[model samples]
Target: MTRRQAITATATLGLALLLLAMGAAARPLLVDEHPLSRPVLNPTEIGFAQDMLAHHSQALIMTARLDQTADPTVVALADRIEATQREEIGELKGWLRMAGASTVNNAPMQWMHPNNSVTDHHHHAATPSETADGGPAMPGMATQTELDALSAARGTDAARSFLHMMTRHHYGGIQMAQAANNLLTDGIVKQTARDMMTNQTQEAALMEIMLNSLTTAR
Candidate 1:
C-alpha cells in the first residue's frame, strides 16, 4: 500500500477506537447499585419483620419474670430464650431500617394478610382474636390476664405458668417465622426465620415436657 493510504488507515482506526472508548465511558451505571437498590421489599418481608419484633418483645417480657420462679431448669430455659430473642430483635430491626421501613408500625399483622380498610389505631372487620389496641392476636400469645397470672404466681406455680406461656409463644413465633421463610427470598431474612422455627420448635417441646412434669407433681 502507499504511504498516504497507510497513514489514512491508521488515523481512521484510531478515531474509531476513541469513539468506542467514549461510548463505553458515557454509558449509564446500573441503578440497582445505588445505596437504596431495588427490587423493593414486598409486604410480607416488611410485615414479618414488624410482627416478629413485637412477638420477640413479648417473649422477652415473659422471660423477665422467670427470675421469680423456683425451678432452676425453668430459669435456665428462660434465660436462653431471652438472650437468643434479644439478639434476633436487633437483627430484625436492623433489616427493617436498612430497607427504609419504620419499626413502629400500627397495623402489625396486616402485612401477613392484607386488607385495605385496616389503618392505624383501627381495624374494621378485624379477626375475632385481634384487639383494637394491639392489632391481630398471633397464635399462642398470652392475654394480659394470663401475663398477670404468670406474674402473680410464685415458686412452682410461676414455673408452670412460665412453661405454659412460653410453649404457646414459641409455637406462635414458629408459625410466623415459617410464613416469613415461605414468603421471603432475602438470604439473611429467610435464614433467620428458619432458625427461629427450628430453635423455637425445640424449645416448645422442652417447655411441654417441663409443664408435664409440673402437672404430674401437682
Candidate 2:
C-alpha cells in the first residue's frame, strides 16, 4: 500500500519475468537450438524412433477400426490410445528430422538386438511380399493379413479379436519404449521415453479392461 512497498513489488515482478524468459531460452530445441542434452540413441535410437512410429500408426489404425465398428469399450480405449501415440509420433518425427535422416536405416528386427544375432519371433508380421526386396521391415508395422482379419470380424467376434491383437500390439509398444528408457543415455529423451513407457504400460491395462467388458457382454 505504501509507495516504497509498491516499488519493491514491481521490481520483484519484473525480475521474475526476466528470469522466466532466460530460462525458456536456455531450453534445448530439436533443431537450431543446441540440444538440451546430447543424444544417447546411437543405432538403437533409429530403431526406436522408426519402429515406434510404425507401432503408433498401427495403434491409430486399430483404434480407428474400433471407432468405426462401434464398440463402446473399444472406442473409449482407442481414444485414449490414439491421443498418446499421436503426440509421440510428433516427437519421433522431430528426432528423425533433427538427425537429418529420411528413414531409419536398420531393419525393424535389429531393434531387438543390435550387437547379437538374436532370432526374431516377431518376424512374421513383415513378409517379403510386404517389403521392398529384403529390406529391414518398416518400423512397427503390422502385416496386411492381420489387417484383413481385423477388418473382417463383426460384433463380439470383432471385439474379441481386437482385444487379442491390441494386447499383442501393446506388448510391442512397451518393448520399444522400455528399450529406449533402459538403453538411451540422453537425459531428456530418455526421460521422455521413460514417461512414455510409464503411460503405455498403464494404457496396456485398458486392453484388459476391454477384455473383461467383452466377456461380460457375451
Candidate 3:
C-alpha cells in the first residue's frame, strides 16, 4: 500500500488510544521557505484574512459551548481548539490593523481555484468576493441548521457534531487560507496562513479520531 494508505490504516486502528493518552498537542514544524509567502497583500488576501477571522470567531463561540457541557474528552479538545483559534483571530486582526484595513468590508467573494486568485494589489481592503469573477469565491459557510444542531447537542453527541461540522468548516477554511497564502505578500499574513494550515490540519485529524470513537461507542 502507499504511504498514505498505511498512515490512514494506522490512524484508523491505533490513533484513538494514543490520542486519549497523548491528547492533541502536535505542533507543526515550521519550514523555512513559506509556500504561502507574498510581498504585497491583495484584495483576495484582505477578504480571506478577514473572512477567516470571522469564520474562526464563530467556531470559538461554538466550541465554548462544548467546554460548558461536553464530556471531559471533548472538553479537552474544545479547549485546545478555542485557544488556538483565539490566537489566530488576534493575529489576523493585527494584520488588518497594520494594513489600515477595515475587517467590515461587504465585498462578497468565493473561494476559487488558483486560476482566479485575487491579490489586494489595489489595497482597496473592500474584500475580493465583492467582485465575483473579479476574485475568489468565499461562500458555502455553515448554515443555521448546523448551528442549531450544535447548540442542541450534549455530551458525546455534541462532540461528534462539532467534529463533523468542524471538519467541513476547516476544509473550507484551509481553502481560504491557501488562497491567502498564494495571494498575499505580507509576512505576517503568510505566517498566519501557514500556521492555520499546520494547526487546523492536525486538529482535523484528531477530530476524525474522536469522531470514530463516537461511532464505535454507539
Candidate 4:
C-alpha cells in the first residue's frame, strides 16, 4: 500500500478508538440517570434487616425488665442475650444505612410471606394492649402483658418468667433468621442470619432444660 494510504488508515483507526473511549467514559453517567439503577440491597434483605433490628430491640427491652434478684444463671443468660443482640442491632442498622433504607419496617414480616399481602398498617412498635389482645406482629414475640408479668415477678418466679418468655422470643427470632438464611443467596446478612439461627437454637434448648429444672424444683 502507498505511505499516504497507510497513514490515512492509521489516523482513521485512532479516531475510532478515541470515540470508543469517550463513549465508555460517558456510559456510566448515563446509567446513573436511569430510573432502573441497581439497588445496593434487594427488598428481602432490607426487610429482613429492618424486622430483625426491631426484634432485637424487643429482646433488649425484655432483658432490661428482668428482675435483678433472679437466679445467677438466668441473669447471666439475660446479660449474654443483651450484649449479643445489641451488637447485631448495630450491624443491621449499618446495613440499612448503607442501603439508604429507613431503620423501621412499616410492614413487618412481609419478607417471610411475600404473597400474603401484608400491609404497612402493622407497626414495629405495636402497643402493649395490641400485643396482649393476641396481635403480635411477628411470630414468637411476647405480649405486653407477659412482659409486665415478668417485670413484676421476683426470685424463682422471675427466673421462671424470663426463661419462658425469652425461650419463646428466641424461637420466633430463629424462625425469622432461618427464613432470611434460606431466602438470601449469599452476603453478610445471610451469614449473620445463619449465625443467629445457630446461636438462638442452642439458647432455646438451654432454656428448656432450665425451665424443666425449675418446674421439677417447684
TM-score of each: 0.77, 0.67, 0.65, 0.81
Candidates 1 and 4: which is better by TM-score?
4
Writing each residue's lDDT as its tens digit, candidate 2 over 1-218 gives: 99999999999999999998887877654245653674534566766777777777777887666535657667667677788788988888888787765554445647556664544535444432245333235333455666667788776777777777777677666766777877876765677778877786776687788788888878
List, residue by residue over 1-218, the lDDT tens digit for candidate 1. 99999999999999999999987776645343347556445667778888899889888988876645369999988989999999999988888888889886676666655644455424323322354344345666667767778878899989988998888788888878887887776777788889999999999999999999989999
lDDT computed for candidate 3: 0.68
| Candidate number with greatest TM-score | 4
Candidate 3, residues 1-218, lDDT tens digits: the string is 99999999998878787875555344234343447654345666676777887778767867865526776777787788888888888877887786678875464343323343454333323433335333323432455556677888877788888888777667667766776777666666677787888888888788888889888988
What is the descending TM-score order? 4, 1, 2, 3
Cα lDDT of model 4 by residue, 139-169, tens digit: 6777777878888999999999999888988
Candidate 4 clashes: the total is: 0
| Weakest ten-residue segment in model 4 by summed lDDT | 120-129
Question: Candidate 2 or 4, higher TM-score?
Answer: 4
Model 2 spans > 4 angstroms off? 1-41, 67-69, 117-141
Q: Stretches of candidate 1 above 4 Å error? A: 1-25, 29-36, 39-41, 114-136
Best by lDDT: 4
Worst 10 residues of 3 by lDDT: 120-129
